[model samples]
Target: MSSNQQSDNVLSLRGISKTFGAVAALTDIDLDVAAGQVVAIVGDNGAGKSTLVKILSGVHPPDSGKIVFDSKTVEIPTPAAAHRLGIATVFQDLALCENLNVIQNLFLGQELRPLRLNDVAMETRSWDLLRQLSAKIPSVRVPVASLSGGQRQTVAIARSLLGDPKVIILDEPTAALGVAQTAEVLNLVERLRERGLGVIMISHNMADVKAVADTVAVLRLGRNNGVFDVNDVSPEDIIAAITGATDNAVSQRQARRKEGLSS
Candidate 1:
């Protein structure tokens, strides 16, 4: 939506809304993600970030909205459908099997050959995927549990790429990671963008958003609050949008100070 043509957007949502019993989780939300761009969705708790992610990931269908993918209106009825449509979501928990090695986890259910169990082929493809992201794993045969937080994230993201998805949704990708690990994940995000994949990064960390996202989309009380180019917008403005404090006491005080200085 930030000057990107509709044709360039790999995923777009219009009039997206969702309700749970009597609670309206989302209302009239609109978003756009162009290919090879990183758009960060930031909001306070209960601001409907999770609901919107679920809707796009096909966990829950929007009550009324149009989802345009590849310039075609489409309905993502299930997670599988979302994947089939080139939409991949990596949730915060990651869902990686700690007991399984990186290679085992990558091809858990989608191995190369069910009958033959092509370990060599799967390992080769896994290495190829990891190399594409410049992952820092010592060995693919090691248990994922032995990997660092950032390494695990790299494995999960690499697995998501196996399907050749056009759009990848990352939910709080740097959460619980150390500063070094966070930087590593952010670098991987840049690699994803370089690969020409649309990236929707949901995070509460303003620093992370500003560090990697091209645009920031704010959600307030389940509605579109504001969207801004990361380079053109300040972190304070983004936080103000998330907290719904754009015209609040602090801003009024700042405005008065500016007026007095100008006078």
Candidate 2:
């Protein structure tokens, strides 16, 4: 994307730090998610990826730092605040009502209540949203329990869009999905980008990241270890960053070999 496009970033974080008692979960972290771009956050366990997502979703308030949404510094004190600010997050659990059908689940808590509940309009919009994402669900009247893993993922994603969020965060979207199902979810991700929405995906699958992410940010021991352009950096380099071994003996030896070859 061009600099102008980047300048229209929907979300930004600067000097964001979080601590739980004595354990520092994050340290001076910085990130940016531009419109129509997918930024994947990859890290090993205890790398503070979950903490960062919580901070962004207002599940946990940051100890210190600034969160910039749509060019304005804002405070996200709670989940409702995050939603009101046009930020939505779909966690791994999905939190869907298994007994409810697609349309009912989509409008669950925020239903058009106290106004005769516009089932006709709500169902219509639900179909429209599914169509927009190219989702493959046989029927909107079937319970979520009957849907496949990938179909459930699509529903979770589609529900998040009901708020018309500018930035959406997906946590392990393709987890537990079969090869075909994984492809389905990835296609939905691309559609989100095509709609000019900023996507921040937390995924451990390198292939998925490489396939859809425009940029990858590596976190190590709760700090910003590295950020790389997907097209410019190799998977090895990203792995090195994730493992905090970019300057280790093995990497140094490899570097020396390359230098010798060049000379």
Candidate 3:
């Protein structure tokens, strides 16, 4: 995947720090998500992955840092503020209404209520959004509960695309999915990049990272270790970074395997 030099980046974070009750959730975190790129963040259980994304989604604020979007530094005080800045996050829960159909769920919070919703107009617009984003969801009439895991992810993603956001954050998009479903979701992520949207994905699956991510950013404990091009780093190297041994060279288990091979 090629990095877009001409395409302006949509996000910049410098010296980001966050804490909770004297425990540091993040420290000195610096990140960049350029428009038209897919950045996958991976880490171990306590790697502060959630904290970093929460800051991006406006669920939490950085104790000290700067958030710059589209050449302007801005404070994201709330989710609504982030929305106004064209930053949309599709969280793990998806927050869909179980009884509502796809069309209804997509327009849930931003419903066109005053003039009776004009179902035709909404569906038409929804169709356009999904088509523009190249989302793989086949139908828009089924309840969100009735959709498959991949389709549900597609809907959640589609909902976020309604406002043509510059930055889209997705949390663990394929966490509980089967192989085929995971493939479907990753394909949708690629589609997002094709549409010129800056995508930041938090995922545990390295295979998905290798498959869909252009750049992989590793967060170790509470600080960002580095960002490397997916093609330039091996999964084993990423594992080491996430496991907090990025520069030690030979991890113990790898040494043991090497010694065994020689024996």
Candidate 4:
């Protein structure tokens, strides 16, 4: 894919490739994410979604690529470097301590006044972050384990915001969530866009993508298949790009049904 550098893009990846000994995980991937927009990355398993996320998250460096953040080419050698560059990634597992409350989890290592331990200040900041996201949690003092799936996701996302990141990458934000819970998470994603944060959501659910994403970036066999406007592209089109063919079962069934209708 061509990396057409747009002035509005907050994050851009060009010629991104990674290899693990004999296997090539990603090859010449290009993606762009603008401020206040949600870019959903969709692909089947082993399509290099996980590898791409790791590169952005600083878990693994790309073998070859250019990562431009905030209009400057930068290197993210560690998780700290990524955060320092205003890129925050919330993985599927969330990495929240079950025993800790919302306030504790939000400021886990980066607490206010580490020597003195400012409880009131941390609690106030936690409430402010949750309120900004319009998160629905009865109390910040409640243990993370007591929260529902959606609530936990809200907490994870809110915590990411504490760094005031220019871009946020969410891995499977609505996976395993019930219908209502999924809707809740989707609403939060919208809120992030409204806050003028560039969001890169990695999801398998096309419905959720259509609901909140402004653009969909599809990766097929570790290469760029297509980038589409969510408003113009159908879910089937995206799926075809993902699976690398239109002759698959879904498209074939739709084609046969269309033929029958025209007959």
- Report the error of model 2 at residue 50, Å: 0.4
Candidate 1 ranges beyond 4 A from true positions: 1-4, 247-263
Alpha carbon lDDT at 102, candidate 2: 97
lDDT (CA) for every model shown? 0.94, 0.94, 0.87, 0.94
Q: Which stretches in model 2 have alpha-carbon errors above 4 Å? A: 1-6, 113-115, 246-263
- Stretches of candidate 4 exceeding 4 Å from the true structure: 1-5
Q: Write the per-residue lDDT of candidate 3 for residues 224-259, one digit (tens) a residue.
A: 887999999988789888887654555666777889
How close is every model to the real structure, measured as TM-score?
0.93, 0.92, 0.90, 0.97
Cα error, candidate 3, residue 83 (Å): 0.4
Clashing pairs in 4: none
Candidate numbers sorted by TM-score from highest down = 4, 1, 2, 3
Give the CA lDDT, 0 to 100, for residue 184 in model 3. Answer: 82
Scored by TM-score, the top model is 4
lDDT of 4 at 98: 98
RMSD per model, one decimal: 2.7, 3.3, 3.2, 1.7
**77-195, model 2: which lDDT tens digit per residue?**
99999999999999999999999999999998888754798988899999999999999998999999999999999999999999999999999999889999999999999999999
Kindly state the number of residue pairs that clash in model 3. 0
Assess candidate 4 and give its lDDT. Answer: 0.94
Q: At residue 141, what lDDT does model 1 achieve? A: 98
Compared to the true structure, candidate 1 yields what TM-score? 0.93
